[model samples]
Target: MRDMTGLEWFKSSYSGNDGPECVEVALTAEHIHIRDSKTADGDRLTVSADTWTSFLSHAVPRV
Candidate 1:
C-alpha cells in the first residue's frame, strides 16, 4: 500500500451521518484506498481501479 498522506477521503452516501459503520474511500491515479471512518490510522485495503470497478459490479445490485 502506498502512503495515504494528503489524500482526500469520502464516506459512502449510504452511510448514516452518526453511524460507526461508515466506510471511507480515497482515490488515486493508480489505486483506491478504503478504510474505516472511525479508524483513520488503522490498516487500509488498496486495490486497482479495474479491480474496484469489478468488485462494485458484483457487489452492487442492478437497478
Candidate 2:
C-alpha cells in the first residue's frame, strides 16, 4: 500500500470493534479503496464507484 496521502477512510458501524472480519473503505472520485482493518497498510483493493455500489447492494442484501 502506498502513502494513501489524502484518502478519506471510514469504517462500517455495523462491524464490531473486536472482529477480525472488519474492513475499512476509502473514497475518491476515481476509485474506491478497501482494506482489511487488521492489515490496512499491507494490501488494499481498489474498485470503481459503480462496482463499489453494486458490491454494497449485494453484500448487504435487501431488507
Candidate 3:
C-alpha cells in the first residue's frame, strides 16, 4: 500500500449526528478508501473510483 497518511479523510454526510457507528472515506487518484470512524487504525476497504461511483449511483435513492 502506498503512503496514504497524507490523504484527507472525511465522514460520510449520510452518517448523521455523531453516532457510535460512522464511516470515513478518502480518495486517491484511482481509488476510494473506506474505514470505520470509531477505529481509525482498524480494518479498511479500498475500491476503484469507478466502482465507488457506480455503487453510489445504484445505492442512492432517486427523488
Candidate 4:
C-alpha cells in the first residue's frame, strides 16, 4: 500500500457497525481507492477513475 496520506475515506452506505463486511472508498482527481474498513493500514486497491466508472455502470446499471 502507498502512503494514502491526505486521502479522505468514506464507508459504504450499506455498511453498518455490526456488519461483518465493510468497505471504504476514497476518490481522487485521477483514481479511486478501495480499502477494508477493518484494516485501515492493510492492503488497498487503486483504480483509474474511468475504470471505476465502468465498474459502477456494470454493478449498478441505470433503470
Per TM-score, the best of the predicted structures is 1
Over the full model, what C-alpha lDDT does candidate 1 score relative to the true structure? 0.88
Q: What is the C-alpha lDDT of each candidate?
A: 0.88, 0.83, 0.83, 0.86
What TM-scores do the predictions have?
0.87, 0.77, 0.79, 0.81
RMSD of each candidate relative to the true structure: 3.4, 2.9, 3.6, 3.3
Cα lDDT over the full model 4: 0.86
Better of 1 and 4 by lDDT: 1
Query: Which model is ahead, 1 or 3, in terms of TM-score?
Result: 1
* Highest lDDT against the true fold, candidate: 1
In model 2, the clashing pairs are none
Which residue runs does candidate 2 get wrong by more than 4 Å? 1-4
Tens digits of lDDT, candidate 1, 1-63: 234498888887887888898888899899999998788899999999999999999999999
**Model 4: runs farther than 4 Å from truth?**
1-4
Give the per-residue Cα lDDT of candidate 1 at 38.
81
Winner by TM-score between candidate 4 and candidate 1: 1
Q: lDDT per residue, candidate 4, 33-57, as tens digits?
A: 9988778899989999999999999
In model 3, the runs with Cα more than 4 Å from the true position are: 1-4, 14-17
| Candidate 1: 10-residue stretch with minimal lDDT | 1-10
